[model samples]
Target: MAKTFERGISSIPGYKELTENMSIQDLPLPSELIIPLRQHIGAPNRRLVSVGERVKAGQIIGDSDAAISAPVHTGLSGVVREIGSRMTQTGQMEDCVVIEVDPEQEKVKYTADDVSHLTKEEIVQRIKAAGIVGMGGAGFPTHIKITPQTKIEYLVLNGCECEPYLTCDHRLMLEYADEMIAGARILSRVLDNAKVIFGIEVNKQDAIDLLKEKLKNEERMEVVPLDVKYPQGAEKQLIYATTGRSVPPGKLPAEVAVVVQNVATAKAVADAVIYRKPLTERIVTLTGDAAVQPGNYRVFVGTTLAHLINSTGGLKPDVGKIIMGGPMTGWAQKSLEAPIVKACGGVIALTREQLAAAQEYYACVRCGKCVDHCPMALYPNYIGMYAELGKYKQAQEWGALDCFECGICAYVCPSRRPLIEFIRRSKRA
Candidate 1:
């Protein structure tokens, strides 16, 4: 039988349409920014710029010889104030470069050589130099994902921002489809002319229709309408939904000969290759009841959450919880000062009432809804029970790390058990 989420799997309420056509408020460029050395999943970049050293935009400040690592750049032209560990979004201390921006912003020029004219190597080098990592919350480098070592097949563009209350990608799809496809072409060029599969959920029919109408002539790039579901944006699930391939647990999609890139990530690649702009800004969804004006904004990396809130008229005085990214996998944050890193897909401002009541968290009723909705097909109740018991090793054996935390299990459970949270806590323990 095919897997699907529960009926009435509630969406993020008040998911109002955020039009990207309007002029978004520019966040006050911070006097200084905290640029972490290890934004990607790999080893931290080795810092090269010392304290008091001046670096320009697109200037590579940290680099690594490690293949899995992506280089880091100074988002703003600035003088390095310090290089040391600081508290990051994930709430762990990591090494970061603190830079004080020059009062007069340094100008970085883009020669405007079209991507079609650039060689694959030239594009790849430009991507690396631009410090272009995934901006759609994955943080993977564009260069690494663009180069497919295997025979090219389908190019899965993840536009299904399935996470609740977040429509950053949605707004982008509705407004920036042309630029998005231009970016997709760069990836396709690198992939040796693979057919494109732009995946968007049924809920995002506007986005689907928008891209479909635009790509009337591009036969190779077809829009694939997917079942509106949680975790649909996940690479493995997306591949299966779009092409019927099971990416085995503990293996990358590439291991099964597939390359998946988020739509936002694809756009970033286009900017790096065509505009020669470093990955410095991203469109982040700022929504939920607590925000004075809930909308999406294109913000530069390293801008503080408080800065965005203030610019958006500040969070309502009684804002209960601040979440970074989509509600499903987002980190519940207590700090307002956390800077918007590259991987952040959205910033959520939730009022007290919007926050889920603890009273709703009931004991497991043995309903097995968790098991039914889990995309990984693990025994969520069993895994969740073991996790609650503090059996970290057993939880790992039960595939705790594999949980994408899409919340389908919790969404369907009659008991309102926090199955994902249980597994997450166990994995951390």
Candidate 2:
């Protein structure tokens, strides 16, 4: 039985034109990289490299023994010019290791022809050492997810790049379907051979078809076409859509015998276990009205957002805002200096006029539109109201913390109320 989702927007403005005929391109190495020690959700990694130290590409410059954290590696061979604090896109000031690229330096590649002989525990260890994390924008360490307290039943791969203006995952599915499948197999092994499913949106028929064709010879895996809705790619929503399992509020998917991973994360697992590549780089969609050249980019993790934009033909003169990810759920950047991290899936630049025209906030009009459109079935209006009054406890009672901050409520609010922002504040409070 397929679990049905209640409410979500079917169409997003300015999304269709961006993904059409998109292909992956590599951004040439930048002159410098500011690698942050805190890219994952857990404890920040401890700095292992100091200023003036020469480091090779893929070398771990930061690590932590904390069970929840992931290591940070240098994306390029360079000498550390500075090691200090810098504000990331998420507004946290973190220790950033600044490296000046050594153009003459040669990169060392690590590849293993045979990883099938390795045990499951050894494979997980390799993934942890490589610093692989959820690349679907959450940045949860992949090793921690594979190591579950509950007995796993289902392993769902999120190929639903439902977020608007992001096509990197779509391209990855089309180009790296084999890698993704291989990684899924490794993940399944880690979970004692849990059933695997690929959950993708119907809008990406190409990716779905490609994966299906590739899986002809494969077994124990299937492709699932999800509704073309905002937030369909969200972990909980994907789990429910594919497996008919709803994760309890404040509970994890593991609680429901489900383990979810992004397609890119799966591919990274394959790369780490087979090719010995670290999580030093990722595919990022650089698109929007302000982008002179909009396409998917294979970018190094620590490269500056500005450098990425510039390398890809630079931004338009009328650019107003630069977002670190997709418009709906991505964080707005105050400056382009924010380095690309493991979780970043796209860098979007919108013209100021366009942003201003689209965002005209007004007071909530007591409309039930937000409630109707909320996929989580939480009352956004009441939560926003309670949050505005600083009644966080009341907001909590209304399920504010349960809100995934998908921005759908705000998108549907005719009054243009920033419901997601209010709910976020309440969650933090």
Model 2 lDDT per residue over 236-327, tens place: 88888898788987899999999999999999999999988889999998888888999888989889998998888998899998888778
What digit string (tens of lDDT, one per residue) describes model 1 on residues 182-293?
Answer: 9898888888888899988877777888898889899899898876667777778888878778787788787767789889888877777888877877888888778887
Candidate 2 global lDDT: 0.87
lDDT of each: 0.78, 0.87
Candidate 2, residue 237: CA error in Å?
1.2
Q: Which residue pairs does candidate 1 place in steric collision?
A: none
Which residue runs of candidate 2 sit more than 4 Å off their true CA positions?
Answer: 1-4
User: Model 1 compared with the native: what TM-score?
Assistant: 0.91
Q: Which residue segments of model 1 deviate by more than 4 Å?
A: 1-14, 18-25
Worst 10 residues of 1 by lDDT: 1-10
